[model samples]
Target: MRPRKLDQPRSWPFIVGAWFLRPALVMTTKRDWIDGLNIPATGGCVLVMNHLSHVDPLTAAVFTHDHGRLPRYLAKSGLFRNRFLGIFLRAAGQIPVERASASAAGAYAAAVEAVNAGECIVIYPEGTITRDPGLWPMTGKSGAARIALETGCPVVPIGQWGAQELLAPYAKRPDLFPRKTVSIKVGDPVDLSDLADEPQDAEVLAVATGRIMDAITTIVEELRGETAPPERFDLKKARARNGRPLEDER
Candidate 1:
């Protein structure tokens, strides 16, 4: 089945503002960054990024549009609580997720359907903005891994810098005067096809998730010219004896 559309609230301005104006700003200030990068023009891919600020999503979406595709994001349900924003989000084909609800199944199902429909799904693996002091990407969750492993979709990892300064996560509002330049570096797509889809062993999932974050970290480090923590995720430790170590360790 195709994804649902908004039948209630009519918020065209928000869609235009979000999908058009914001992306245009990113292009101009960043010196047409998307035009300089190599992004695939077709296919059902997952754009994963480190969540430093709300602008992360907009930046990714703009890149997708520049490469000739529309992006569908899985957003927290809280954003939709406000009657106005809810209308706009729904109309734009954004997925609503209840981050703290007992029934997050609906959100996941929506994401699966969107991907199956050949839509580019944008997801923040961190699930929220990074709280690290340096604005680095925190330990990400396993949902993105699960999706990629299951669908065999190409997961495009993007490292975003400068978005935090453009619109700080906890700030009351963004600095609109000087027009901050946000940099988004898109990494090569990752294929999880080689990994098994069995979620029974938490160790397997942990290892896979770490690999996903590692790709994001590499891109971030290259873009910002700063090294991330030595250990982003301890999948081996998390797995204990169930973890798979290299043969060289033997």
Candidate 2:
């Protein structure tokens, strides 16, 4: 499929990134981008997707860029540790998030600001790669919902597969030859209008997050042509089932 013409202005960081990364992606993987125009052409929005592989973000970025937007990801703070890489990331408009800490709130605030500024915020609601044995999306966190409610921006759900073929989750090496296909299906904006004016309570956020995940899972079901487990994978529950203690207690 032809890429949507890039009419939006891009900064030097984006230009440089595309110059370096896009070519490699193009050469190594075939894209099966479905309904990419579902991503807003202009305005602040949150694009939430199920996390599949470590390298999925590159595919996600290319998918977003192909449809005419630079994806500003809420990346882990650890990624910004390198002095030069940090500078490049900051220049590229990526937000550094301290995962699993009070400081993560800072990233939430930064995301809200980016959304308000009309930037496209790419968030993996699962936060990390899936642990489901079948690679179905695990239960998600509520960060994406909070940002959407705070900014009243559209929340678009994406279902992706095949990145694992290129680089399986937590795998050190990638299989680049033979060219894996990265397929992503973009769903319509999740219907959170009823909850738009509701108070930002835990229950409200969960309901919104569930809707977002459900929408994404539906699309993933479409892509995989199978049924996902009735209950999404829960890390703590899995650990308990295996007689393993939670991380903090260990």
Candidate 3:
């Protein structure tokens, strides 16, 4: 399979930050961890992460830098509409995907292409910021798994915390003062070699995605030492909406 071509360099700032700035910041409330990890400089791979706040992407970028690799990510189409930020996102090798469309197959394809091209593609499996009242990870979408199965790329489960403290969800701006510590944990690469020969099945893909997410959830609970909500993160809101009885009979 031909690898996807990433027409831009996204890891430049992260590389700069890690080499020059991360050291200074490491001293104050700073933390990061990786276990049984190996991030290949060239190859197709997916970095699946739990989302909390906007800072999630930047933190992941920093993780790639520290591990000596370039990272590409899928961003919502809305962010690319911005004049300046959009340019930066594009130059940094971010792929803009339209979620409202009937299908986001194009974006997923692009990610696969990047992997085939020997680049690391990052995806937030949750598909959006956690609405978890407690701000932990929510149930994830199956797109990440689909990409992994299609491209034969290893899915790397990532767990993150403290981005919410840097900038709480729904906050207008990030909190910069006390320099809150952020931790990123990378687990062993999830080998998808078994699925390479099998044709894609929705059920099989979902199970694969769920297994990867479960790994991430365990890490987050370990880091925070609290059990996450048992409900699948993605279905909670839809279930709530359906449960509400019809109202307002005039």
Q: How do the predictions measure up, each by TM-score?
A: 0.80, 0.94, 0.82
The deviation in Å at residue 204 for candidate 1 is 2.2
| Candidate 1 lDDT, 147-218, residue by residue in tens | 777677778887777777767886768765476677777778775655765662567667777777888888
lDDT (CA) per prediction: 0.68, 0.90, 0.73
Give the least accurate 10-residue stretch of model 3, judged by summed lDDT.
1-10
> Order of all candidates by lDDT, from best down to worst?
2, 3, 1
Give the better candidate number (2 or 3) by lDDT: 2
Candidate 3: segments with Cα more than 4 A from true spot: 1-29, 191-194, 235-250
- Candidate 1 yields a Cα-based lDDT of 0.68
TM-score of 2: 0.94
Q: Candidate 2: misplaced stretches above 4 Å?
A: 240-250
> How far off is residue 9 in model 3, in Å?
7.4
Clashes of 1: 0
Candidate 2 all-Cα RMSD: 2.3
Write down the RMSD of candidate 3 (Cα, Å): 6.3
